[model samples]
Target: MLSHLPTNHHLRPLYRLLALASGVYVLVFGIIGVVQTSGAETFDRSGDATALGLPTNPAFAYASVAVGALIVLSALIGRNLDFYVYSVVGLVFQIVGMLALAFLGTDVNYFNFSVATCVVSLVIGLALFTAGLYSRVGARADAH
Candidate 1:
């Protein structure tokens, strides 16, 4: 699958860089969540007013940290397809979790942000997946 990619060196580097950046962002967010949860900080529940409170559960924080670390490690190892799949799954989980929180009114503002981040991550994940497909197709064509 790796051999079918096009010879365009430009796309490869761009894809790698984007993946790396996304991974780093995820890792940072995850680490922050872990720290916040470990410290037992109270998440703010105010609606778009201030982010002084913590999320309802520290479990989400821990999960975020673990997922983020996995994303970063996957990207660094050039596992683009695996990264994309994992990211999409993670984003979906986040979206559902955020929606549930919103319905429960646990923290509307925080949930809103969570939804937004999930959407953004989903888009990035889709793009990465498409890029991987393109590379695979290109590689196959080259072998013909």
Candidate 2:
């Protein structure tokens, strides 16, 4: 189904850079969240901890750090590995954002996500998806 997708796109470098920046942002945010919520329980849902203007708890913070690191590594090792990673991760983020939005004010909001976080997640997801779609590498004959 994706056979028509472009390869060796002119904007591939820009897309890759965007993905890298998103990874760094998530990583830094998670680190700050971990520090800010150090006193709280690992999965505590009662605290009002925040990082980079996004609501977070220890669990979410740690998860973010791991995900961010993965993205960073994938971007660094780009070759098509990044395309797959970014695509999958982007979809996951999009799902997470929607789920977070659905459970915004309820007890199921384990991530402590605010509207801003949801918005940012969606944006980042789209960015990553775009990068994945166009950042592919292949032989010159494959560019057709």
Q: TM-scores for all candidates? A: 0.54, 0.96
**Model 2 clash pairs?**
none
Worst 10 residues of 2 by lDDT: 39-48
What C-alpha lDDT values do all the predictions have? 0.50, 0.91
Off by over 4 Å in 2: none
Q: Which candidate number would show the highest TM-score if scored against the true structure?
A: 2
Query: What TM-score does structure 1 among the candidates reach?
Result: 0.54
Q: How many steric overlaps does candidate 1 have?
A: 9
Q: Quote the lDDT for 133 in model 2.
A: 91
lDDT of 2 at 45: 76
**Tens-digit lDDT string for candidate 2 (1-144):** 567889999999999999999999999999999999998987777658889887889999999999999999999999899999999999999999899999989988878888999999999899888888988899999998
lDDT string for model 1 (46-84, tens) is 223212242333445555567666666665665345435
